[model samples]
Target: MVVLSRRIRSEDWKPVGVSELEVNALQVVRSVDNRSVIAGPGAGKTELLAQRAAYLLQTGASPAPRRILAISFKRDAATNLAARVRQRCHRIHAERFDSMTFDAFAKGLIDRFGQALPERWRPRSDYEIMFPGDRDYREFLSRQIGVPPAHIGTYADIQAISVKTFERRHLVGTPLPLDGWLQPTPAQWAAGCYWQRFLHEGKKSFLSFSMIGRLAELLLRVNPMVQDALRLTYSHLFMDEFQDTTPIQYELVRTIFLGANTVTTAVGDNKQQIMRWAMAMDDPFSAFDGDFGATRTPLYNNYRSSPELVRIQHILAQALDVQAVAPVSKTVGTIAGASCAIWDFSTPGVEAAHLAAFVAAEIKAQALSPRDFVLLVRQKASEYATVLEPAFVAAGIPMRNEAGMVGAIMLQDLLVEAVSKLIVNVLRLAMATRAGRHWTTCQEALTALVGIAHDDEIAQAKFANELDAYVVTLKATYPNSPKSKVASRAIVEDILRFVGREKVVAAHPAYGQGGWLDEVLDSVAGHLLASSCNHTEWSSALDVYEGIHAVPLMTIHKSKGLEYHSVIFVGLDDGAWWSFANDQIEATAGFFVAFTRAKQRVVFTYCSHRGARTNIATLYQLLTNAGVKKVKIA
Candidate 1:
């Protein structure tokens, strides 16, 4: 018997759920040497990191009393990684694993060590965070740079979204342009003034996520004691999605963990580096290796797609990364039809109607859940919704645009998902004659949502009882038979009152519980009003929807790190991917990511009359070579 750790034997271990890529990578999981792992989509990067944490914690490899910090780029990714570690190890061991976004990690440092920063850079305790756009910077500059109100044009009227960053030199207090204070140009002057005013927001500093990263870096460099404390607290570190790491974020890691005798692992695929517009590093692997003296490893197995689909991926992968080899598929080809196909239409409305009718008819014939299919668009899911919504509505299929905004919150916000899913399932479970399997899953989700460890018997028991008591209250309050239909919007309000909106707000500080959360709650409840379904039909729209009965329509970027039974790509013409010619590699990479998000079959829909087909010429050639069938509907 091969012993992985103290209590984990070979047969007892599995990577992620339903992903049995085996424990073959156990050596890397248990390795002490710092490494940068590059793997394609569905290669099980999350599983590898989770298993590594499990191995280190279970075996005391991290030298006990010390913890492991894993930083991810997204909230869901971080929470999912933490949940996996909890599921794989004992409660005591699992509690040592800490996973959070890079922003959250940096924000925490500022919250704790702002007083240690130089007086000029220290933020007030009540500083508010804002996500500013480029327009905000331009508008702020228009006012401070002596641009006349008449000449300021549209910028004069622009409302600032945040305190924006200016040119690198001016923001750091360097006005080395051809001119002085206002600099060579008004823009440079605005940049310098913006930096000066960043800390002077009426006695309350305004900080952005990037600003937080910069401050965190400054704090560590000036105060080595803080670094020493962090090193003492966490002996091992993992950076997930390293390819998307920016220069300052990388520097933040280098200052604290480099040569501090900490084992650091960075895992990501350079090909999937999609945040270039936000200034993702040009070469993260090389940069990380240069700093950490780390070795490189790549996992070349595709566990999420069928063999035919893998071949289609190879067609696009070669165009994106010539040096990288294609991943062999672990999924067998079982779909009776062609693994890939394309549908051509003369107009967007025709295409949308055909797609909705096709999917709805297929569900009726095949007896499959609507959730089995996912719709992917290049960007702005709402643009496609105008045509898609009515078509789907006529077809009687429940589909929600996952990328749309609700007031100030994106529909995918963690707090929104937690609250929305909780209410939907709670209502369903309440009216049922018997408790279903969903209740157990829902309970676990509630536990994780409130930051409870999976193995904490006392806390779990207490929460479970509280949940039962809450349900009892709900039963008495809304007592009805199973057939009694309820309003989805009302359910949202009910959960808010039952849990006390304040408590929900206090639980997730990431999104806040104040006016912002209230706006989100109100907008979410209003959004549900878009659905005409009384109750049963509305369940699909409001549920967390991990399983059957809901079709998730989102952008290709949001669809990463996920898979579905089938995939539908809408708007595959030049207009949707307008910048394809400028950055063909990244464009191809986006298309690659989209196609790889399928388990059995994938479909693409393009409207010839909608836009020019020249941009996606390579994709067309690749699909044809992979034997993907094409059909036109006029």
Candidate 2:
């Protein structure tokens, strides 16, 4: 791939206000010693970013700076944008498009940071961070530390718990005695609280990748080499899904490129800022004026939807605080024959089942291709997999689960499994041979290994003694058991064998029978896991491609810049739907985003009970009052 002169003329680009806003944003970024962009939902932020990158690379006066670094919150978004840029450029610089998820970008930083750490402080693993989904460690911490389960739960729950714990010890004295007891100092209380948490659930392994964002910010701020190296290495910075960046990430961006002439543009829809769990928040609208000196623009003329569908969204926007700047109050989607349906599901399970049934019906009635529809769950919560999956399966709908690798054993999990297996092996060997001393040592290892291998440990003798004894046992049992072959290669092979490669592939959601699943999976997994050649290489799994039959479900954020023949808005007006402050903006913004997705028709469905009934009534009222002429509800 090589860079060439711009093939697309300046006149070829669309001039939506948002498009102009994006252009202006880039111009400011070009002038900024450093810059940040803030965009609201339906703002065409990503499109502007892609256009800006393509524009710069195509129009650069001289040697275009080394590379243009475009990052996304998701690997898919990054890869998609990279491809779009390649197409837009009319030529691709294979190395110039440094599009990667922030995590991937941070690992490069970690490589440098690891070397700077004191020898004693060297990290146990140099690999990517892993976050456990089960909250098992949190539960263990709660039990061990005498904190209620209600306190230390989810990531949010842990923060709340930490705050409560901090307050309980420092603000209130321990078990206020009937007779006056000596009150502890605030410092002493805080120290005791810290000790309690550390003694219980303070394992370093529990740190999530999000923490890397925090650490990376600190590194860039503190380390001149890191800051200089980044700014010097990359001259242009573009971010997609910019609204989803957390404060920590914002700090990281500031530290890396402060006072640099490098062009930096962040494009994202604030209404679509959905990753709150990871601390991602929509870039405040005011930030554009303050941080980047950006001018806001509206992309009101949606090219995706028809007039009727577009009008419907305008009415729904009243439910939220922000109004959608709809593109011309018209829908002109490609799928003009599509139909929308609204169904009332009284409960969560009912909603799940109704969605499943609706998808199944659509596949049959429309004779639609499986690949045409996608199911977009609200979050990556287990509720979808546990409850919704079963409903879909029970409905006899052959749906493709697009959820990423949940069933597969993560590397952290593998480490935990190996430790458990090692303890069992030691105990079993000692029990069979009746070696009391060996058994006792092995038991001590099992106890100590739990904390030592996983967390910092002051005692090294326990580890050394356990390793020496394990070697002795291996020597004694080499011929009888599969011992003495604990080399890295052999260990890997053994683990894979124990993991049952066949079983893993069989259990994979994507691997379950249709178009291109086998082919796509093979290509993706082959490229990603090329180092491992022990497994069979699959050429095609067309059977997997054939299974996609669900009514397409997707988040409104993903649906942006995309259109469907028919659109159904389910679970609308649920109090839970707009529980957060940002939720209101996203929901109203979603009304616009969702409406634009429909080609011919749109259906908004919610439960009859609760506020849903009132919600829909108000929607109808707004639509009729907004010159919709005739609004019908069935």
The TM-score leader among the candidates is 1
Candidate 2, residues 290-322, lDDT tens digits: the string is: 665545544444444566555555555544434
Using lDDT, give the best candidate's number. 1
Cα lDDT computed for each candidate against the true fold: 0.72, 0.47
**Per-residue alpha-carbon lDDT of model 1 for 1-634, expressed as tens digits?**
1223355454454443334444435657867899898888778888789888877776667767899999987777787788778776665676678888898888878877877777667777667787777677666655544543444334433333134435332343231222224323334445545644776658677877777787788889888999999999998999998888877788888889988888999998888877766657789899888888898877888888898888888777777778878788887886677778898998888988899998897787767788889999998789887778788878888677878776566666633255665665676665455657557766765776676776688999998888888777776765532221234446567777765665665555544511445565565565555433344433443343332456779998887777888899998889898888877777787888899889888999988766978867887888887788888888
Q: Report RMSD (Å) for each prediction in the order shown.
A: 5.5, 16.1
Quote the lDDT for 561 in model 1: 73
lDDT of the structure predicted as candidate 2 = 0.47
